[model samples]
Target chain A: MSTTEMTVHAFTRMLERHGADASRWPERQAAERLVVRDAKARQLLEEARGLEDLLRASLPVPNPTAARMRADVRGRLSTGPSQQLIDWFDRGPLWRPLMAALLPLGLGFVLGLGFPEPAADDDLIAAVSLLAFDQGTYLDESLNASVEGGEYAP
Target chain B: MARVQARDSEALEHLMVRHGGALHSYLYRMNPNPSDVDELGQEAFLRVWQHAGRWRPERARFSTWLFRIGHNLCIDRHRKYRWIAPIKTDETVETAEPTSLRRAPDQAFEEEQRRQAVRRAVAELPERQRSALLLCQFHGMSNQQVADILEISLAAVESLLARARRALKEQLVQFINTDQATQ
Candidate 1:
């Protein structure tokens, strides 16, 4: 912990800080002297070296997955969360939501079939038909009148 | 980083390409599960993009801030989901077989076994210790950077690294001895 002074503890701290690479230690001369002169320091240096070598030898190489992950991350960022939500839906089978949205319509159809509809009044039906026939007659008259007139001919 | 803060996808992609491998390596060291590493790495970059506005350049380095997000994510996921799955330790050895190490089958196999042991030893370390060791050994992050990322004091980081390395040294002593002998 006392990294300020040139002590054995400080030497080990340096080992932890910079690994066992003596070339990287700030107090390289002092530390090397400790390693040369102190058995405990030497042992600590040995252990640190062993651990460092194991770690370096075993560390995974930076492979092409970085590019793959970068592309993936780029896709994620560009698409944003909403796009991702839509993509999630796209990934799932399509029918589920379609059925959900149609559920109300289907329910209405089923309910209409189950319940009897109120009958329309006869007078209302007669008025509707009469109104339709009059509109048809009015249209027939207008068309005949238009055909007779040269200005409105197609 | 400035460009990333400006909501630039290209800048974000550049950052990903630059730091993605180190992030993946750090995540792998924390949680050796392949799927989890990819998920965490992607999520880290995603957060960087999403939260870029919040980063104060004068306060901390971009790399430190990015790693802080990752460290918090890992901790939160662990707390919420009962931690990253224990490493299989099987795949890392194979994934890292150096091409230079291609030699006699028996020696290669022995080397593979040694690396596997090292991974197992690292996996068994306590959470903070493992993080410290991995961030240092994997990416060569200094104690200060590790402290910033882990939000621990430098002394705490030093203690964690010392303990973790000590444990690894003890566990993998045989391999280390053979390695030393070979040298």
Candidate 2:
């Protein structure tokens, strides 16, 4: 379409198609041409169009260090213990408390099973303390006084 | 347990493999500094791991949450470090590639220089204007998406983009002509 014949909307649409900015149309000329009604606007548009051309034609592409990035991330992730156990714990929400409690119990069980003599010693100590207490005698002052006064039978 | 935070290293790796490039690209475009981009992207993933347990399937999609994490990291870094540099055109890296043999060297070089100049001009603009341009031009995000990312009204995005384009034209006309003449 002839530039003179183009509507503002049409011009903007054209600019969009060309990947140009529509708002920067030269205001003077765009205003003068009431049909496009924005001569200055057109000029701004033209300039913006030129800049957009430069941007698109010349914009540099970034080549990210994908391999290096992966290695960096992998190295950081792998240095720690495998998350597999943690993940299993996470999946079973109810098992957390049980898992926590089992550690002490398991240790105790292993000690009992692994070395049996210490628990046996503890049992012997308990029996000896009980026997010592049972074999001891206590004097009864009230009984002795009654026997002395002859007020109590044998 | 949340699938991601279930602490599965293999799963974490898979997520990284799947989304790392795109996320990095988005963050890199938003923040001009390469160092900040690298750090922020990793930080975002770390946050994902930390908060994965709270992820509800019904609330949002994984990609959306991921993007939100990345976007938030960018904002936090912006506040902390004020990463104010404009998008830099690394022509050396761009033109050094033999695969890019498709374009004539002289023309490509001049064009790249022009773009670098324009990028600097855009950087000098107001934050809103620069943001609009980055979203629209560099990332090719739709206007609606740009608005969403910026947390502004669509009309506001349009206005910012408008002002941005005007400023760019006024600033880069001379550079554009010089580059074109060289070509």
Candidate 3:
């Protein structure tokens, strides 16, 4: 592309990047002057203006008075220490990290206290005794049945 | 902000007066419902009041920080409601009709139709793109400020805006051509 063509292309790209307003464009005063001088660039700028007009036209006019909104927000702000606590959490440097470090340890301590372990020796003895009793009962019953049927003569 | 952190109601009120209208306008654009806009605006400010102590000027400008709060509230409300609320275009059309009666009938009708079409197109844009466009165009924020508000990179903001403008132009191409032809 020729130098002029390249400049126009760059200007068009700038228009697309930053809407119709040449003032907001990074190239600033030079591009504004170019748009004024160059017919094609001016047309492109007009097209951008049209799009911006459409955008603005479509927007609803918002309520200007914020009295009600301000009152409501202020009411909420007047409440107790929750906001203070949140601010502390957000802005307090030492407390937050300290809490973060203590959270898991606190949770583990609570869980440990809630579910205490049973005595290991008592638990083992109960299981062994139960197993021995079941085995003896099974052997006695088998012998009695065999004797009654005379299957174990000796 | 320091005064607000110090619990000065006057400082808070001043900040509210300065920024409240823009915040409300932003929320209204995000959600066309007035009630929702009011609630969200209040919530955003309440947060600013609550978190005033946390405002670090080195991080962002006050407006950027405040808009971020409003944007997050809007996003939360959108997620909670799943954007079930319809855009309130009927009232706008009705209001526009009375004034347009004094103008040429055909031109007025076309203008109204184009306005509705543009509103619908904007409402249909992806949330991020819509936010980017609204912040950039309507709020007069720079792309960098939009990036900061949306918590995205500048390139992402630019891309969202490009896609948004492209979609809007495509949607309104016929209206645009007719408008230019008439001009």
Task: Write down the C-alpha DockQ for each prediction.
Answer: 0.19, 0.12, 0.25
For model 2, state the Cα shift of residue A126 in Å.
63
Q: Compose the digit string of candidate 1's lDDT tens values, residues A1-154.
A: 3244378988876886678876667788778777788999988887777778778777564443877787777677667678876744443245545666799999999998997555667678999999999999999999888889865767
Where does model 3 exceed 4 Å of error?
Answer: A1-6, A33-39, A80-113, A118-154, B84-86, B90-109
Q: Write the per-residue lDDT of candidate 2 for residues A19-130, one digit (tens) a residue.
A: 3543433333443354355675556465555676666554444666556566666665554455645633432234464686698998998888876568789999999988
Error of 2 at B171 (Å): 1.1
Model 2: residues with Cα > 4 Å off, grouped in runs: A1-49, A74-154, B1-12, B52-65, B86-92, B96-113, B175-183
For residue B35, what is the lDDT in candidate 2?
Answer: 78
The deviation in Å at residue A85 for candidate 3 is: 10
Residues B31-127, candidate 2, lDDT per residue (tens digit)?
Answer: 7677777767776676677688877768655655676677766766665555576777653345444764656888667656666776677558886
List TM-scores for all candidates, in order.
Answer: 0.70, 0.54, 0.74
lDDT of 3 by residue, A1-154 (tens): 1223237888876776677876688777767778778999888787778888778877765554588877877776676798757744543345475796899999999988897477887899999999999999999999999999999887
List chain A TM-scores, every candidate, in order.
Answer: 0.40, 0.28, 0.56
Best by DockQ: 3
Q: Backbone clashes per model, in order? A: 0, 25, 0
Please, what's the RMSD in Å of model 3? Answer: 6.5
